[model samples]
Target: MRPVPDRRLWLLVLGFSVWGSALGFVYVLHSVGCAFAWPANAIRLGLGLVLFVHLALVGLLWRSYAGTYPGAPAVDPTDSFLNWVILWTLIAAFVTIVFTLGPTLLLTTCT
Candidate 1:
């Protein structure tokens, strides 16, 4: 029988999965809005809100991980992997937020 993963590992995986799913959802929302000729301001506002929520969720995840596992040891492979995954996920989400906001800020109307 295969051993189940640790709770922390499961939490980390679920957190990142949700983060990635949110990113994709935002993209879909923007695309659908554009396709349907929604007002630029409306679409931008909605996307911005979604992005803000995503950032908040990711921040909470980071805080929770830190609180639960204070001063994780460097020698533990799972801890190190989880830390790296969380870091990269945050970076990716930040970059996505910037990309999504850029067009909204630069263009007043959908082209």
Candidate 2:
């Protein structure tokens, strides 16, 4: 038993593992020629570009925004936890999006 925080970190790791497993399955389906729509490469490229812009906006805002308070408690556990959750969720989503689109773009453009 590590600790509550460590356990939460493990849970987050598990969630990412599940996500990777699911993406792997999708790749298998794609390999066997079972994919629907055949995924237009142009669409993948366009969407990837759009996603990049969105990610850039998020990064800029994340750096520019400041929520610190002078009289706030030393450490608000709930706020910290929520921030971690939100940040990791966004990171996972971006990773998945890139993984999915990268292959599609390559397949489309290469073929």
In model 1, which regions exceed 4 Å deviation?
1-7, 69-109
Task: Tell me the tens digit of each residue's lDDT in model 2 across 11-85.
Answer: 445434444544554455455433444446544545456546655544543443224322346646654554466
Q: Each model's TM-score, in the order given?
A: 0.61, 0.42
TM-score of 1: 0.61
**lDDT score, candidate 2:** 0.49
Off by over 4 Å in 2: 1-48, 58-73, 109-111
Query: 41-87 in candidate 1: lDDT tens per residue?
Result: 88878877776787677677666655435256543555656666666
Clashing pairs in 1: none
Best by lDDT: 1
